[model samples]
Target: MAKGKVAFVAHCLLNQNAKVAEFARLPGVVSPIIGKLREKDFIIEQLPCPEILAMGLTRWWTTRDIYDNPGYRRHCRNLAKFTADLIEDYYRRGFEIILVGLDGSPSSGVRYTGSSDPIWGGRPQATVDQYKIVPGKGIWIEELEKELQSRGIPFPRATGIPMDSQDFDMDKAVKEFEEFLGESSGVQG
Candidate 1:
């Protein structure tokens, strides 16, 4: 039997085409994609309801779905919790899952490009590209990877955090992410 359940960590950023496409395919994200992920394809998903006074209550009250706090501090925490919970839920069912989040930055009310959700508990991580854009500091991919490693879950080690400086080609991103996600699905143990 599969060791853990598969839950994708897809972030619906960019155009609908890209977001929906990634959700439909890709690896590391939630499963039940209609067709096969090309391992070289991409696309990215939505949100869920949370029970009050539950896990990370501080996060629940202070997180998203209520206020639009500054810097999206709350949203970040909630996202991390949500993402982690999603994965754990799947694992509980004996299916190894991966959360390949496709994060980006875009104004609110605009297309779902990225979220301000930071990775709580763990220190901030910044990619090379992030430094160039946001400057100062950023969230590193290693933090998440380490957490997953502790649980025997494969974490995403994407070199660059698809910052869109690459020109934001939805088609190319979808293809690459799809293939990457598919490649990992088989080893969900």
Candidate 2:
């Protein structure tokens, strides 16, 4: 039976192995969040990790400005167009589409992104304290939105998994997502 509901999520949410070495909070999947979506009967789809796709597994940690370039944006646009095609197909079929992003990812953040001082250019810093999480969409998310807009598809309801918090607040993340899901109950595809 088709439930006509789909949730597109950041890759690392389902596979922590895909994240940067020091950033993997879980051993594998984020069961709490994924379980909630499963309970709601929404089919989950993992979006491709733009950083891994573009820079390979050995890539170092960086800020949004580092990835905010023509080449990276073009690569993201291509990925977005492909994903948007899938999104359009589901939309055409009248499925409810929801987006879940990594809150501080340079490539996939939906509502808040990671940024650092303008002087961050050369070598990777000795520490990550200089990074700050601020309100904004990441490169890949922006490209995806633009791709969807060009195709005349309204952006889907989106929420972020807040990984930027110092302690990785799982409770807060779940609460926010639960609230978003509750609010989206009345939304129609």
User: RMSDs, each prediction?
Assistant: 11.0, 2.0
The TM-score that candidate 1 achieves is 0.41
List ranges where model 1 is wrong by over 4 Å: 1-7, 13-75, 103-163, 186-189
lDDT of 2 by residue, 87-172 (tens): 88888777888999999888889999988865467866636777788799999999999998998888888988978645578988
Q: Which candidate number has the best TM-score?
A: 2
**Candidate 1 per-residue lDDT over residues 57-88, each given as its tens digit:** 22211212222333443444454455555554
User: lDDT of each prediction vs. the true structure?
Assistant: 0.35, 0.85
Deviation in Å, model 2, residue 169 alpha carbon: 0.6
